[model samples]
Target: MGFNEDRKRYLAGLEDKTYFMLGDEACAYGAIFAGCDFFAGYPITPASEVAERLAEELPKAGGLCIQMEDELASMAAIVGASWTGGRSMTATSGPGFSLMQENIGYAIMTETPCVLVDVQRSGPSTGQATKPAQGDMMQARWGTHGDHNIIALSPNSAQECFDMMQECFNLADTYRTPVILLMDGEIGHIRESVTMPALSSIKPAARKMAKPGEDVFGGEELVPGITHYGMGQNVHVTGSTHKANGMRDVTTPHVHEALVKRIYNKIDDNREKIIRVEKDISQNGQSKIGVIAYGATARPSLGAVRAARDDGKNIDFMRLITIWPFARKQVAEFAKNLDMILVPEMNLGQISREIERFVNCKVVSVPKIGGVPHTVEEIYDAITEVAS
Candidate 1:
């Protein structure tokens, strides 16, 4: 179908209403509201609800929702769909996400604009399909091969899952790169009341289209626009090194070097514009410690920080909304004059490593694995330990 028709059909399926729903289901509705007309995903725990809902709802909206044989095909299908000039997405948990890495790399290298939702579960390999863990935190940033930059957002609540899915699509389209919504299974399965804003309030990013006679990958614009396959653009897309016209140039040293740098720089240069975080600092401006957390773990950390404040401690809390393309500048500024910073995560010090890179203060990691979130007391104790 044509772009307008697909978009109109998708828009017709949206309703600006409030409802209590699981994060996964909220994500599905968010996709539809965001004008996503194509969904290709394999069923996996905690993330299966997303595909299930889309399977029923997408077709009704005149879109296609295909259950691929496996995660590999699912990831590939979404990339192919994006070339057809439609928004596409897929959802998966740990094992399935791992299976999608190679194709995820292809999507990144080719600059395909699409969304990927990884509802994290306990894992090394199928460690616990139904349990929650933030083990995939680092994988979302580096699971795909080679040196590349990708946008990833973390949603700590069902409302955020509903809200950030649209942001994910916007970021993906705006940059012509795959965006990941790194959600944990706990949040995915938790049900919460969500009030969706008016449809008009959501501003989605439009895809940049190459002008007639312009090379698909050629432009002074860092993120070059793309033309649909049959539009006579004659674009050649490959995972290997390519020139502005998209022709494969695997042997040319300069061609590969230039293309790779452009891809990486597109994100690096825009890092400030992309990174987001929620901060509550010392009101009296005497905070000596800060707590940094993301994903589901941020929930408890927020509570712990509040309790610490009640006890007359100078504690600042920063919740990460953008996980990848780490908010180095923001955190570094927050870290200034602070005695220490504590990071509480569901895994063993994944993002803590990144936090340490940007901050000069004492960085402490409070990791809790085995499919459970850190309690308020646990986080508070860690804060106390570091503060002392």
Candidate 2:
């Protein structure tokens, strides 16, 4: 079926209502609310709830939900579904996320729009299947080889999980690329109150279609519209470097370079619109210590900032809502005036490395692993250590 028909069939089931929900459950509903009609995922801890919820709910809403053989197939399936002009998604944690890497890269090369949720767990290889960790932060940005840009968002609460998933779909549709919703086991299992916005308030983006005479992949727009597989537009979808007409041109260096550059530029050039960060700088504007965090780690980091302020420490916080594309420009701008930046995460200094790259100032990494999140006291201690 065509995109509109698929959307029309499934979109009617999403209703405006509030509920106390888990982060994983909230994400599933958000995807449904954002018009996801195809879900292909393999169950894995902390993230399995997402797949479970979709399995029961999607069918009730006239959508398709498949339990793939593995993460690789899950990722591949969503990309295939998306080409048929329907919103598609998949969810998995660390090991499964690793398995999905190659297909994720293919999604990037093909410029297919889909959403992948990585509800992170501690792992190099299944270190803690049921535990929360932010070790996947660096992997999320670089897991799929080659120089490519991707949009990733981190949600610290259940409400943000619901909210960001909608943003993920809109971003994917808007840019014609995969968007990652980076969550962790802690938030995924945690129950919290979430206020559902009215249906009128949630405006999901429609898939952009190529004009009758336009090439499926032709246009100067960083993100050009695409014609679906059976849409009667000459569609040539391949992972190799391709011409704007969507035909493979592997032998030409210019064709390869141009194709790759356009993919990166579509995201990098529009970074400002895609990036979202919550800032809590002191009113005096004299804070010397800055804390940068994302995902579940941001929860305690925010508390630490508040605790430090109560103790009269000059500390500020920047919680990343958008994790990928690195938030480079904003980090650089924030780092320039700070004495030190503390990166508190569940992993051993993954994102801290990125912060260090952009700042000449002392960059302190408060790394914690093995399933336990950093306590507010731990983050506050790091802030004091940096200030001293």
Measured against the true structure, the TM-scores of the candidates, in listed sequence, are 0.96, 0.95
lDDT of 1 at 257: 84
Query: Can you tell me which runs of candidate 1 are displaced by over 4 Å?
Result: 1-14
- Local accuracy of candidate 1 as per-residue lDDT tens digits, 1-388: 2335655556544556678999999999888777788999999998999999999887877788999999999999999999998999999999999999999999999999999999999999999889999998889999998989989999999999988988999899889999999999999999998777675676778888899878777568899988887787677888988899998989999888888888999999999999999998879989989999998899899999999888888899899999889999999998998978899999999999899999999898899999878999999888877767
Query: How far in Å is the alpha carbon of 155 misplaced in model 1?
Result: 0.6
List, residue by residue over 1-388, the lDDT tens digit for candidate 2: 2224444455444455668999999999888777788999999998999999999887766689999999999999999999998889999999999999999999999999999999999898988888899888888899999999989999999998888888999999999999999999999999998776665676778878888768666578888888787777767788888899888899999888888998999999999988987898887989878999988889899999999899888787898888887888888888778888999999999889988888888888899999989999998888877777
What is the alpha-carbon lDDT for the whole of candidate 1?
0.89
Lowest summed lDDT across 10 adjacent residues in model 1 is found at 1-10
Let me know the TM-score candidate 1 reaches against the reference structure.
0.96
What's model 2's TM-score? 0.95
Whole-model alpha-carbon lDDT for candidate 2? 0.88
Clashing pairs in 2: none
Error of 2 at 88 (Å): 0.3
How far is 221's C-alpha from truth in model 1 (Å)? 1.4
RMSD of each: 1.8, 2.1
